[model samples]
Target: MDKVNRFIQFNDESVETRKLLLYERIAQALSNTPYMKVTERQLIEYQPKEATLAISVFWRHRTEEVTNLGRLSDIYLLSAGFYRQFDLTAWRTFTTDIKPHSYPKLARQLLMLLEEFRMMESIQKSRAGTQRAFKVRRDIYAEFHRDRLLSNAQRGFLADALINQLYLDIHIGMTSSPHDVFDRLPIDRVRQVAQRIFETETTSQSASLAFQIIALVEEFLTGDIVLPLYTFGEAFEDGKPMKQSSKAMESEEQGESDVKETIEEEFRTWHRETEEEKGMHLEFDLQHGTEGASDASDSKPGNEDAEVQSFGTGRSEGNEKEIGAQPEIEQQQDQSVEPTLQAGSDYGHAHTQVTFKVMEVANKTDTSSLSTLSAWRINHLPIVRALVTEMKKRLERKRQYKRENLTKGRLSSKLTTMLTDERPKPFYRKQAPSPELDAVFGLLVDGSASMIDKLAETKEAVVLFHDVLRELNVTHEIASYYEDTFEASKEQQPNFFEVMHSFDENRVDSGPAIMNFEAHEDNRDGFAIRWMANQLGNRPEHHKFLLVFSDGEPSAFGYDRNGIIDTAEAVWETEKRGISVVHLFLSSQQPTEDQRELFATMFGNKTASSDSVEEFASQTLRILRKLLAIAVQ
Candidate 1:
């Protein structure tokens, strides 16, 4: 086999573009609107009915330079945690304006949003602490490739940032609404600027890397490319049984036809070339008038000296035309033989290397066998599944290894047997933790008039988080919002209401909250979120986090009776206590003055607002983690 023989054809331009698109789509799917499950983080694409939240809302990561599914997912989650970065207020204004038959609303909205985004971009630049942390975080992300898992602490770091910092003043300076975030900036124009900056930055790394990439792509498209060859899936197509008759028959005929012509042509060409080479060798010997000699003639037969024969063997000649003619003919023979030997050696070496490589691929049968490969080559559970699918694919690969070799090398029989053995090993079967229970801490929902819709999704989160937490045997307490003058002072950390935080110890907490709409405010910060954070803060060393299930406005918290300034003071006090808050915007439609105020006060820029309860959970959890990340370390 020659270097030319070890070639594989692939289309580059279309193929690379297709691959790049595939990668981009994967990013889209993972970062799509709505929420994906904790398990579905890497497996981002989903049918609408499969989830309660929009994929975009739930996904909390952004586009990355690399395309590793896992890394992209993390980055996606990171972005999803801060989904407000790419504000769609401009688009939102476009729609709202269309409804009103007014372009001014749209124009103002776009202008405001563009200003906000520009501010955000500037904020990103000015914030040295955030940039330093992000740089450190990028380094930690590289560790994830090696470790395959971000420690709880590392995840907490990201969550903490999202919860505490609004991604470095990207939303600072002027007050802005969702419609004002990205409205002003022309998307095409902005993209052009970004593209130019990137082009300038990337040009310095390698001037020809882009061109090399293009060249490699063109070679594939034109069918003028070659790749190293190795054996794979040989036992699959020929050895595996087909599940369906139609597929079996169709593939059977196709496989037979294709393999027959291909193998025949290939083998015939190889054999013809080989014979031609052998004949040439014999011809050169005869041309030198070297008659057939006994096997014992080259050196002492069956002796060490026989192996010592040099490259330029003296040609047999007698009574030549002249002395010069004899030496010249010998020189010609040397020239011819050396080049032939060189060509033969090159082919021979390649064949040997390829054979070994072919044998190196594993023959996996099922998930269990795939587990072993994952244990060796990977660390993520998601990657293990991909390997299993690829291993099970029934394709016929040429057996370039485990065959005859023209040269002899050391025989490491033990190693050969070890590698060739096909054994199954189960993966993703991580044993649950002992007792499998985390500590207990339940949420207090605001069952006020405005919070009714918000509670549905909040209740669902309670159930899900409870189920997972309970399985881990973590004890918890449940509480809900209800204001009363009967409770004590803000510094004293008064209870929301009488008996609002009680639940069956043996069961998961799902107790009803005591709503106090008639009481001071609507029970927002005055009692609900304020009281709950204080409660969680009291119990330390448990992964205790609070999900402030509210539209977050303090209007419901009776500012008239208790004074709005006091409510604001309570919010700051809660923050000082290290209680993380995840705001779940129940319904942005007809938002109360209170809801709008609360949404801005608590969530800042990355607020989670959804029309549907179910759809809200996926995004809520992502936001929860990001919010919690700030408090973790």
Candidate 2:
């Protein structure tokens, strides 16, 4: 029976994964932002700065399509419509005015609740497809709040009951309170104001209405809000509106009290299911003499008195300049434009606390390094030449086309008779003899410790990639990445991308610098891909390609559970920006079926497996040929 239950649980998880993938694609399309992602949380919230759209998991029990679609539509409306139109300055002013009121939290919840109606009305009028989903939402909420209204009124929580009554009236045309317990309250005036929810067009206008209603009803309230179930998300603090907090804000209402005691009390009084209602709590602390204390000591190779660097939500000057503006696709128009990178935008939520440092290869000009480069170049010169020849032939074939009758081009000797006869079309043009490939490439070589034995062959393949691109006059960047696992801790993990060649140094003779590459501690594939994609997205080339060379394993500090999913998401986001990604699996013998399947899931079908050095070189050339062909075409 236990095995059978486990099988059922696995199937349920599989279905959820597939559903989340589909929803993510929908979010990317609807938001018109390539980096926009959908995730599951306790409530429907939109974090614009993080580019995350979270749907409430409470409604997951409703397996009907209408309920699911309505939930997704709610996130879409929050992300695309309300986030842009809401006025943060006005909201802050309102919150300050009501901060000392008897029902400050209830007043804030009322404002959010009213804003939803206004936003839904505004967004649904613009998008026709959202109509049915919203109808489902209205029907479901109408039923749920009817029961909540009766319960709150019976407990003498007038303000909370009033909120429920207002919601029912606005959405479902309910009149008066459910029980006649609010005879002294100004129900008629409140309903008159709530009726204007459909009339208000902006969040500021909704705030005005909410303020008026709270003024008339605050004196009748007694305690804190019975259940702040109508919140959109966390209120804006510190001026960065719609940004996500790294710490969980869902536990704030419960304070720092005993979790079990608080939950038990709420259950006994309200008969409420508050367990899943409260989202996950996260805490970070610095501990001394823990399990892995030696790993954090300076006895490691590079951790001797090193300075601790910090990564924050704010963008650095360099990051801003690197992620400058580009063309954005119009959401309403049917056109094909490459996705743009907003300044300081992150592709996925992983590695939010991680910092990346771009470094040059160490000891590049040292005597031993120079000697190694010279000998290495001598050993691999033959294969590099051969690969260059094969790639150039393919590129030339793609560039083979001619125009015999052109008005303005190089004069052809064969068409001289037409010119003599005073014909208008006498000139002919052939393709440029040495045309530039309208493409840029980024090669991210894995620097994990697992690559130690394969470093020699890997360098050969990399040198071939670099030398050929140089021969063809194409712009490309080659770098290796790794994390210092020995020195890593919970609060901070530093990743490095050591550059052997950059696009700006295309004219320089740095081919020998490729010999300085070495295997390092660990590899975080998703973070590395995202960093490289950010660099490549700034280029003006028409075609962009990112090639990753690894053994299809992503291992790093605190990256075990979501490593594969995050890597796949990074690949999807990069491709959405019109950059093609291909993976090459390096191994000695043939890869097992599991390995191949893993690579396929992460990289899609654009993957190649190499069994030896010769096969690696050949596969690298083949991938380049395909990319160049796409570029020329």
Q: Candidate 2 lDDT, tens digit per residue, 1-633?
A: 001113354443322433566778876676555556677767776554445667776666676796577666666566656556666666667787887778777778888888778777777878777788788888887888888888988888877788788888888875544458678778788888888887787667888898898888777656768777755545243333232232324444446322222111212222122222222122235687665445554575557688868544433346543555232322222232122211112435667556556776632456775676677668767766875676677668656767777888888777657757676676777776645778899999999887877777788788778877887788999999898898777756667888888898786666567878988888888998998999999999999999999965678888765676678878887999999999998876677666676677778898899877557777887787778777767
Q: What is the C-alpha RMSD of each candidate to the true structure, in Å?
A: 37.1, 15.9
How many clashes would you count in candidate 2?
0
TM-score: model 1 vs. ground truth? 0.26
Residues 1-633, candidate 1: write the lDDT tens digits: 001111342421011122222334443454463222221222222222121111221222433333333333333422232222322323333334334432222223223223323432433465432344334333444343223212322443322221111212122211222112223323223232322222222212212222222222222221111211111111121322222345335866777432222212222333333334332221234266566766764564356555655544334575444333446644643543222111121212111111000001111135653444334223323433442233223111111123322134434334454355564122122222222222335455554445554543454554444433333344555444543334423322122332233334435232222211112224434344555555567675445555555544444212332223333334444555664444556553544444444445434433466655655545544553343333222
Where model 1 places Cα greater than 4 Å from the true spot, the runs are 1-442, 452-458, 484-521, 556-558, 561-568, 588-598, 602-607, 624-633
> Best-fitting candidate, measured by TM-score?
2
